[model samples]
Structure formats: C-alpha cells, structure tokens
Target: MDRVPILKIGDILLVSIQIDMEDQVALQLQEDLAERIVATGCHGVVIDISALDIVDSFVGRTLATIASISRVLDAETVVVGMRPAVAITLVELGLSLPGIRTALNVELGMELLARARDEGVNEDGDAEDEPGTPAVPAP
Candidate 1:
C-alpha cells in the first residue's frame, strides 16, 4: 500500500518512483496524480523511474494512462530515468507506451516542458491561443 510521492516544483509536478511498483500502487498513483494536476494547476508532470529496475506491461499502461489524464487536465507528462534494460523489456513486450514523452533525466524533462509552454503549445501540441487572440506574424 505504499504511495508514490508527488512533488510540485515551480509549475511542474515531479513524481519520483523510489519503490517497487504494484498494481494497486500504480492505480493509486494515477488517481493521485489526476487530483494533483487539477488542484495545483501545474502545466507539466515529470516521472522519474531511475530507481526502478523493472517495468511490467501493467506499469507501462499505467504510465500511458497517467499521461492521457494529465493531457486532459491541460498538463504535459514526461517520463525520465528509464534504464536500458527496462527499455529493452518494454520493446520486447510490444509496449510502445504511446502518448508519453521521455527524457534522460529530470532536468531535460523540465526543459522540454518549458519549451512546449514557450511555444504557446497546449498538452495536445496545439496552439494555446484562442481564435480571437491576436497573433504576431512570423518574421
């Protein structure tokens, strides 16, 4: 029944998975993350899995689900710190983990999120301005 810790840094929510992941734990994380995204109005989520040595199909799906939920809440999700073995296992299992962006580490992940925001892009990668908003012509 161990719960993952979700930390808010600036406008981003950082989730570092330090313990073994079980089905119940993953589900709880998904639920908790959704709530945090709404409550904090954060624009990005970074999941650090560097400590984890393995990832099963259920965990992979849970990651994707978390990303989708974050997008729906107007936030972006980035998964970082995936070990090489974990990546191989995921590929071998045919878990493409769609809708999830990855970085080698948290710093890069935050940079990616900042770049997305600076480009006026939403979680869907669409422009964030409304139709009536004035747009500056490209130079």
Candidate 2:
C-alpha cells in the first residue's frame, strides 16, 4: 500500500498527490492527514493534485471529507492544482465538493491559508484566537 506523505511546513501541512489514488489510498490519506494536523498543530492544509488526471466520486468525497475533518480540527484546508478537465468532470459528475476551499496552485493556496490564519478564521468560517496573540477589538 502506498501512503501519502504529509509534510509540515511551518504551520501548514502540504500533501502532493502525484499518482492515481485508489479508494483505500484516499481513505488512508484522510486518516493520516487528520493525525498529522493534530500532532503538528498545523493551522492549514494544502493538497496539491495537479498530477492526478482523473477524480472519481469516491476520490472527490474523500477530498471533501479531509477538508471537513481538517476544519473541525481548527485547521484550514486548501485544495490546489486542480486541472481544468478535472474541474469540469467533477461539476458534470455533480461533485461540487461543497465547503471545500480551492486554489489554482500551491502559491495561491499558501497565501489564502496565511490570510485566513492572520484573520483568525478557519476554513469553516469559525473564529480562532492564537494563544498569546492579542485579540482585535470589533469596530
């Protein structure tokens, strides 16, 4: 079984899927990602799928599940590097992946994560305050 490696960069977890993922692999990835987020105290997750040429319903749901799980852990999830064909196929297949944040590439994904973290908001729109950080007063 091939396991997806999750890299911790500062406060972000980066996952680059470079192969065609089977259902079991995707499930394993979901589990591994959640564990990594909790273990590393990461504030964001960026999944790069640029190399994946196809995404079926199972894969799509797995991605969504990962995103949702990350959010519940107070970590933002940004799925980047979605190919144009994959996007169209997902839409056509009725897999819109609601509540999952996306970016064109890793650079933009990192920026989004940084902005969200700086604003004290998680991917699920919940407000979070970093310890020892001064809270901003509401205008």
Candidate 3:
C-alpha cells in the first residue's frame, strides 16, 4: 500500500522510488502517474530508481508500460539511476526496454527532459510542436 510521491518541477514530474516496490505498488504508481500527467499537464516524467538494487522482469515491463502511457498522454518518461548489475540482468533477460529512455542520474535526466521540451520534441526526438509556441532552433 506504499505510494510513491510525484513532485512537479516546472513542466516535469519527478518520482524518486526510494523503497523496494511491490507489484501492486508499481501498478498504483502507473495509475497515479497517468492521473498526475493529466491533472498537471506536465511535459515530462523523471523516475529516479537509484535505491532499487533489483529490477525484475515484471518491474521492467511495468516501467515500460508507464513510459508508453505517459507518451500517449503527451508526457515523456525518463528512468534514471539504474545499477550496473540490473542493467546487465535486464539485457540478459531480454528486457532491453526498447522505448524507455534512461539516464545515469536525476540531474542528467532533468537536463534531457528539459532539452527535449525546449526543442519541442518527444522522448523519441520526434517533433511535437505546440500551437502558438515556437520551437527552439537547434544550434
């Protein structure tokens, strides 16, 4: 029944997962995140998983589902702070997380999200120009 907190920073939603997540908790998070994205009209989501040492296949799929849902809602999702062993395990398990974006840490994740937003692009680097808002020209 533990619920992860979702904080808003500018146009991004920050979720720092500090505990070992249960399956139900992960599902709840996905639901809550979708709700938050709709309620806040946020442009991005940064999930900090630095504290999680193990990410099983279920958890990996849940994360991917969350990212896909966020993208459909017009919010990009960035997962950060994966342990090295977890990365290797995920690859070995054939869970490459094809559509989920990632970063080494929260700072870098935030920067990535910000740059994507400023450039009017989605996490996939696709142009998502908002009406009446000019896209920042690439340098």
lDDT string for model 1 (70-123, tens) is 989989899999999999998998987788999999999999999987775453
Per-model TM-score versus the true fold: 0.84, 0.83, 0.82
Which numbered prediction scores highest in TM-score against the true structure? 1
Ranking by TM-score: 1, 2, 3
- Number of the top candidate by lDDT? 1
Measured with C-alpha atoms, the lDDT of residue 96 in candidate 1 is: 70
Model 1 per-residue lDDT at 17: 93
TM-score comparison, 1 vs 3, better candidate = 1
Query: Which portions of model 2 miss their true places by more than 4 Å?
Result: 121-139
Clashes of each: 0, 0, 0
lDDT of each: 0.90, 0.89, 0.88
Tens-place lDDT per residue, model 3, 1-139, is 6999999998899999987778888888999999999999998999988888888887888889999999999998999999999899889988888899999998999999888877764433443454555777999
Regions more than 4 Å wrong, model 3? 121-139
- Model 1's alpha-carbon lDDT is 0.90
**Candidate 1 clashing pairs, residues 3+ apart or interchain:** none
TM value for model 2: 0.83
